[model samples]
Target: MKLSHLLPALIWLMAGSLCAAPPHSDVRIASPWPAQNTILAMLGYGENIVGTSMVAKKIPLFRQSLPRIDSVPVVSVNSGHELNPEQIISLGTQILFVPSSMTVPQQDLLRQAGVRVLAFDANSLQALTSRVQKTADALGPDAQDKAQRYQHYFDRNVALVKERLKGLPQDQRITLYHSMGNPLTTTGRPSLNQDWMDLAGAKNVAENWFAGKQNRRGEVALEQVVAANPAVIVAMNKRDADAIQTTSQWAQVDAVVHHRVYVNPKGMFWWCRETSEEALQFLWLAKTLYPDRFADVDMRQETRRFYQDFFAITLSDAQISDVLNPPQ
Candidate 1:
């Protein structure tokens, strides 16, 4: 063949290949964020996961729902900020997802090794929904439709809660205290934790407890909690709820006195956190706060349907209970 003729043919072929290829097709992704891992699986990208973090693997829902999860290697200890690009590249990873905390240099290391890097920030509801859509986009066309459906479900429920609580007076809003891992540590100030309370038509006593990005502890003295005296307490677990109930200092708190200490559900990856399951958390809180208003909403049935609809996993009653209480 003539050199000129062969060169033109090759150029045309290369152009066609580039033009026809789907964005992120044949993607092999690894993520250190447990919240992201749960969302990825929910969006039907579980099969593409070649690596994940240890925290994601420990989630009961992942063990039960995603078989590929067991085969995926753990790339980092907690977050993927210090991920080894050589290790990830060797695994044939096309994409690596790190949290917003991941440094630019770390992401650049993977990028230089021919891997795309994506960052997820899941501090707010807006951030969570954006993560869902962006993740679906990265998974190619097949997952886009599923992301849309989930978004619709999320928007519908958010609207329902807003409509139900549209005219709720300030006095009617329940005062809430949400504790995290420890008794004093709560998701204070602006975050999805505070958003949950707002969506549920409740007042958060810890909303202004600790303010600033530098303050990661989110802890307030026990006395401040007693002074606020929340009407309801949403503990990280049943154990925390019990601590508030039985502890002498907490006895005077209104929530403790009224027996309104409820344990937050720990699902795919702590529904209370930035996981896609935050949709359920908002609903659960709405009902928990105003039982009379949301009497028709049953969380157990919603949970079963959510897993079946999104991840195609059917849960037995016992399995559902396991995630809700999640054995101590």
Candidate 2:
């Protein structure tokens, strides 16, 4: 046990320990949506993803490459069975990321299975930023730098929105529809889209009766929209926007006739990747609805800056446009 002899043994042990530490290049993860997958990929952890839910595979980036668990709830599913707890654990995921709508049973199952479940809230722009940082922290040291960068862009983007909306008169604020799905459903007060629209200085008409309701899919008659006469109509997806324009039944609405229709892309899951694409959609909606107030703001350039400063990705104007205006 001479000092020199012990030194070599200690060095050998140290090397083995270093090798034993998990590598950042690969890790098992499960997500409820494709946007989270995209966010992870943007953070340089894309290659690390081992498994994803069916929804995550829809994005072009992961559509072909990832394995589908068929574990996610159908988009039409409003309440229970949204999360397949057994299938999630069967994927052998060390960490599971879920949307904010997780149920009590799902939480119990994850706890029993020893899987770390991180729920992200995309309820508002601020909530989205906090969730992004929390997700980054869960990924350990490899994601530290990327997490800091993500926070930076989030801060910059939100600040600009507040600054732009500060001096707008109440009458100057526009009326918004906050459409979702093929039916062009508007936000019912509790819905995340409604909150975002409010932040952007738009008045959400749907909140009139459905305020604080449990059901987000609350529907109003075409007469309601026609009478409210919103200055602008915000559609969640491109298909929804097109349906409003082409569908005979919807043509009766004032928004369609007035040409106030605005489409927001489904980025990161609009419900969860709250910090990234959802926030971008908010800014885009703000600028689109109130161009005069945000005249100096260039959302495309801002989006590119977000990609560069936060996700470390270089996105061109065409690529950004494609996300904004998906193929019909």
Candidate 3:
């Protein structure tokens, strides 16, 4: 038979098996958030994933681990913000994981379709931890063990970094300018990126200027960055870091002059955001801000171990380098 003709039969068989299993045994999960997918994969629930948002397909680590990911249908509209309820229903998604940014009406639409909606706040470390635990609990009792193990690993790594940097005085911390894809765009106190900087013991220059602003992300003129003259500039990606370094207007900035600009790492997910790899992000940021203090830290080893422990995959040397120094 032609492969096209067999596809419908295959889908029917899979859907039948999914529906035939006990109510909680064959749960089909869909999430618009790549971080939540990463958490599910870490909890050994990758087989339960039936659908995901369009953005999840672009994550290199996710693609590397989940070979069948492309077979899963996307449940969001092209706009990236709106959910496609019809497509979601077609995919037979039982549970939908969404970020807190999702509006009430969107959740209502999914719930009305018999899809249970689980919303998580990924803005802070505590919130991210809670989300992970809650997601594991929803999966089942067996998943709780994996969640606790991950939590233990997270707590231990964070405490280690905290202890190492505890003695440093507040005045001695380095000042950082975090470039959110553009040199002119930066994150302030309201953003989770700011939380990463705080954990790394680096001060965010944008927070001082945008303290009372309602928006977490704000744009400042090139001249403002030159005026702030932060000690270091960290870009979300290599392209952004290169742009900051080459811009003529940034020539006089302290970070540009001193060549203190660096790109944050991109793994299964962007290290700048809340993800299962957050503990590694903290370590990487801390090391970037204070080399001498974290000189003994082996980034390659840490990255390798994180993938092995969390995703149950071992990365090659080239993969490790790619995650740390992604292409521009």
Candidate 4:
């Protein structure tokens, strides 16, 4: 064959091979939700993130987990109600991950700008695991393996907790009241926070009280909380826990009176949320509720292992403690 004829064929073959190659390596992603951002970072796609919301910026561990996170542009829209489509387009984002709560118009705007948008509901354990899988699927084939491993770890941890707490009498289950921030703001039935309480082998005092309500969080009068008199009082952070402890009105509440007030751990994301760290949150909550049953579970070691295995980061003793017990 002539050299000129062979050269054209070779060039065509090269172009075909390049087109067949996967595009995941070049994917530029943006997420306005902190939970989804944490999941993506855990899946080893932190380097692909081109934009983030204000909420993601506030997470110290999230920032620490991704060395290049600061370089990502902030694209929060209307004080977090939506995402900034213009900034996202400007950053060359190929994909945008959002919570299911995002409005249709917000999604439309991004799609019109040529960005593929994925919305996942991470409100329940099932939804959260499914979202993880979906997010991984969007990333590429390599991420599927990570997602499966994560799901297995999550299921195994949950099963371990369940097996250990099997046949626990309902009466013995610790009843907990979750203080959102103030004593009045609390979590109830149908909420992810309540799901955490249930998985931890504890009862939510506000479960039936807010039945049929659309919102997950509601304000319960202080009188009602004192009347319920839960065995444990769980707060999202130390500030709320301290408020519950110091408030004179709650002095007589059983949880406060017995010094059973506890704070949920906060890290890259709130452990209490239905994020990738839910398995750890379940273990922590279970341990806090029934110390005798979970005495063998070293949370510090578990935290270190989860980060190392999933996020590929090794946390120090102090870092683990900070995650398990955040400052006020």
In the order shown, the candidates' Cα RMSDs to the true structure are 6.9, 9.1, 4.6, 7.8
**CA lDDT of every candidate:** 0.80, 0.63, 0.80, 0.81
Q: Which is the better candidate, 2 or 3, if ranked by TM-score?
A: 3
lDDT of 4: 0.81
Please give, for residues 1-328, the per-residue lDDT of candidate 4 as tens digits: 5544443444444345445543886788888787888888888788898888677787888889886787777866674576655566656677788788875354554554456888887567788889989999999887889999999999988898998899999998989888776667886778787777788899888888877677767887889989999999888878889888998998998888899988888888888875788878888989888888988999899999999999998898889988988875
On residues 1-328, what C-alpha lDDT tens digit does candidate 2 reach at each position?
A: 4544443444444345445545545556767555667667656666556555456656542432333423333222225737655555555455777677664245665555555778776655566566667777878676767777666665666788899889889887888776665554555666566667777788877776575566555667777776777777767676777887788776767788887776665433442224355657667788888788789888778767765665555666776776566553
lDDT of 3: 0.80
- Among the numbered candidates, top lDDT falls to 4
Better of 3 and 4 by lDDT: 4
Give residue 14's error in model 3 in angstroms: 14
Clashes in predicted model 2: 2
Runs off by more than 4 Å, candidate 4: 1-22, 104-109
- What tens digits encode model 3's per-residue C-alpha lDDT throughout 1-328? 5544544454455456555454554788988777788888888888789987566778877888998887887766444466665556566677788887764344554554456788887677888889989998888876788889889988887887898898999999999998876768887886678877888899888886677776577788878878888999988878889988897988888888999898888887787777878878888888888888888899999999989988889999999998898875
lDDT of 1 by residue, 231-254 (tens): 999888778888899999999999
What TM-score against the true fold does each predicted structure earn? 0.88, 0.78, 0.88, 0.89
C-alpha positional error of residue 132 in candidate 2 after TM-score superposition, expressed in Å: 0.9
The TM-score that candidate 1 achieves is 0.88
Per-residue error (Å), model 4, residue 228? 0.9
TM-score of 4: 0.89
Best by TM-score: 4
